[model samples]
Target: MSQQPPAQQQSHPGETGQMQPRPRDEMADYTGRDLLADKKALVSGGDSGIGRAVCAAFAKEGADVAIGYLSEDSDAEHTAELVRRQNRRSLQIRGDVADEQHCHDMVDKTVREFGRIDVLVVHAATQEPVSDFTELSTEQLRRTYEVNVFGAFWTVRAAAPHLAPDASIVITGSVNGLRGNKTLIDYATSKAAVHNLTYSLAQHYMQDGIRVNCVAPGPVWTPLIPSTLGEEKVEGFGEQAPMGRAADPDEIAPSYVFFASNRLSSYYTGEVLAPTGGEIQAG
Candidate 1:
C-alpha cells in the first residue's frame, strides 16, 4: 500500500515524471510464470499508471503487448521499452479512443504487428469532477460517454473478428460505478454502462470460447487522480477507504494478470472483480 499523495495537480492527460512521489507503475519486483507465454495483447491507455503497469506485467508473463494511447509519446515509448526489455515485442499505437475510426484502427494496427490478438484490455477512460450536478456541461457528458462507454464498445467490436477462440477481454470499471459519486456523476454513469457492457459481451462472446471480465478499482494512486481531482481531494485521496491509503499501480495489476491467464480464470466470465482497498459492497 502507498501513503496518500501530496496536494498536487497536473495538466490533463498527466505524465508520470511530473507526479510527486512517483507512482510504482512499473511492476519492478514481479516475476512472471509464463502464464501468457507467446500470447498477443492490445491495451488501450497503455501509456501510464495502471495501463503502464498492466503492460509491464503482461510482458513479464510472456505476452507481446501493443500499447494504444492518445498522445503521451514519451510515456508510451517508455512502456514499450519495458515490454521489449522482457524480450517480448511491443508496438505503440497512438490516437484518441473517443474516435470510432481510431478505435478500429487500434485493433487493425495490433493485428498487423502481432498476426492476431489473444487479449484485449479496454482501459482508456477520462473523468472530470463537477461541483454541482446542475453544472455538468453537455460537452463533458458526451466526452465522458464517448471515451469510457462508446470507445469500449467500438474497440471490442472491431477486435471481435481478429480474436481467436479462448481470447480474454478485460474492461476497466470503477468503484464509483457500483456506488455512485457526487462529484463524478457522468463518469460514474459511464462506468456503470461499461460494467453492464462486460456482462452483455461476456454472454455474446461465450460461444466463441472467449471470456470477458472487469476490474472496478477503488481510489488508486495514478495520474488520473492528480490530473482530474482538486488538490484538496488529492491530499487525502484514498483515506475514505478502509485501507486508509491508495493502492499503487503494482498492487492492482495482479488482478488483470489473473483474469488474463486462462490457466487461472478459465471458468470465470461476466465477473466483476473490485479491488477497492477493503471497501466492501453488495452486488
Candidate 2:
C-alpha cells in the first residue's frame, strides 16, 4: 500500500464539520413538531456526518441521545454541543464499534445513563478507494468488514435485550450496497450484508416488538469524501449526481427520522428508505 498524504487531512472514520465543502448538518429551514417526544435514542457513529444530523433530529424531536463513535473525541464533543443546543441530554462514548466487547459496553452505558433504549441507529461504516480494487489488502478487507458488518451485528446483539417493546433499529446502508462499488468491493459487500441482515432481523424480531430497518444514502457529501477521495475528486462531487449535487447530511437524515418514529411509520419494517437524490440505482 502506498501512502499519499491526503490533500485535506483525513478525519478517519468521517466528519461533516471538516468536510471540504462542509455538509449541511442542520435542517435550518425545517420546523419540528415533536415526533419523537420523550423517546430515547442510541446512535452509533453519531459524532458527525449523517449520524450527526440524525442526532440533531433526534434532539429536535424531543429525544435524549446516547452516541457512540470510534476515537473521535473532538468530533464527538462537537456533536454533543449541537445536541445540547436542542436542549436534549447527550452522552458521548468513545470506542471502536469493531470490538464486540466495546459494543456491549456502549449499549450498557447508554442504558445505565438513560435508563432505557427506544431506538438504536447503526450508522457507522467503512469504505476504501472506490477505484482501487486490486490494492485492497487482506488487512484492509478485514478492517472494513469488522467495522461495517461485525460492528453492526454486535450492536444489535447487545441492544436487543435492552430494546423496549415497539422499539425501532435503523441501520445505515448505502447506494453502493445496492449498486456495487467496484472501488469499494469489501465495503460494498458488507453493506449488502447489512441490508440482508436488516431484512432478516426485521422478520425474526417482528414478534418480539422490535423493528429493524435500513436507510441507504447516495452521494451525501460527508467528510469521508474529502478524506477518502483525492483532492480533485472532492472538488466537484455533486455535479455527477442526477440531483446535480452531493446530498447534504440533513437531506439524508430525515429517512432515519422517519424510520425511527413509530408514530410515522408504524406499519413499516424490514424495509429500506433510500435517500439518493433521484439516483435510479440503490445500494
Candidate 3:
C-alpha cells in the first residue's frame, strides 16, 4: 500500500466499500493463539475502521463478538462475516451510539447473546474539521461530545455490572487528544475528555479487578478520514507525523489486542498506548 491515499471525498459516516483505497481492516494475515479463547466482546463502531480490525483480531483470538454500529448495515454484515469465518459467533446491533438508550441496548443485547462481557471497546466516534475555530458550530460541538464522550460513558456504565475480574475496557482516544489539533477543535476536545474518562474509570474499576485503558492512534487509513476531512486534508493525511505516513488499521489493532488480553496486560490499566507513527508526545 502507498504511504498516501489519493485525494478523495465521501458522504458523512462513509462506507468502507466506497473508500478509494480500501482500508486494511480485516486482520487477514494475522494468526491467533487463543489469547481470548471463549471470551466475549462488544465493540461499539465495530462496522469499520479500527473497530472493524479489532473485531477481526478478537475473533481470531477465539472470542465471540457483538458489533454495535450505526446505519452501516453492509459494513456491519461484512465485519460479522469475518468473525463468523473464524467459527466465532457474531451479533450485529445497529443504532447510533449517541443515543443513551442505544448505548445501553448495545450492552444488553451483547450480554443476552454471549451471557457475559469480557471486553468492552468504546471506539465509536465522529469528527468534522473546520479550517477556522469560528467555523465550528455549536451543533457540531454537541454532536461530537454526544458520540465521542457521552456514548463512551453510557456504554461503559451499562457494561459495568456485567464485567467481572479480568474483564477489560478499552477506549479509543486519539493523538489529537494528547496534543490539540488546530482544525479539529471539537473532536480533539471530545477525545481529550475520553482519555480522562479512561483514567477515572480505571481508578473506579481497579478495586473490582477490571482494567480500563486507552489506545490513542495517529492518522490511520480509515473510512472516517475521507468522509470527514476535506479532500486536500485526506490526500496527505498523516504526513505531519514524524513517519510521514498514516498507519493502516492492521498496524493499529495489536494495541487493542494487548489491552484486551489479561495475560499480556495484567498489570496495566489507565494507560494510554499511542501509536502515532513516530509523533512524540510529552506527558
How much lDDT does each candidate structure score? Answer: 0.95, 0.84, 0.94
lDDT, model 3, position 174: 98
RMSD of each: 0.7, 4.1, 0.8
lDDT (10s digit) by residue, model 2, range 147-220: 99999999999999999998999999988889887777998899999999999999999998788899998887
Q: Total backbone clashes of model 3?
A: 0
lDDT of 2 at 237: 69
lDDT of 3 by residue, 10-125 (tens): 99899999886787899999999899999999999999999999999999999999999988999999999999999999999999989999999999999999999999999999
Report the number of the highest-lDDT candidate: 1
In model 3, the worst 10-residue window by lDDT is 1-10
TM-score computed on alpha carbons, candidate 1:
0.99
lDDT of candidate 1 at residue 265, scale 0 to 100? 100
Question: Which portions of model 3 miss their true places by more than 4 Å?
Answer: 1-3
- State the displacement of the C-alpha of residue 23, model 2, in Å, after optimal TM-score superposition: 1.6
State the weakest 10-residue window (summed lDDT) of model 1: 1-10
What tens digits encode model 1's per-residue C-alpha lDDT throughout 17-97?
Answer: 988778899999999999999999999999999999999999999999999998999999999999999999999999999
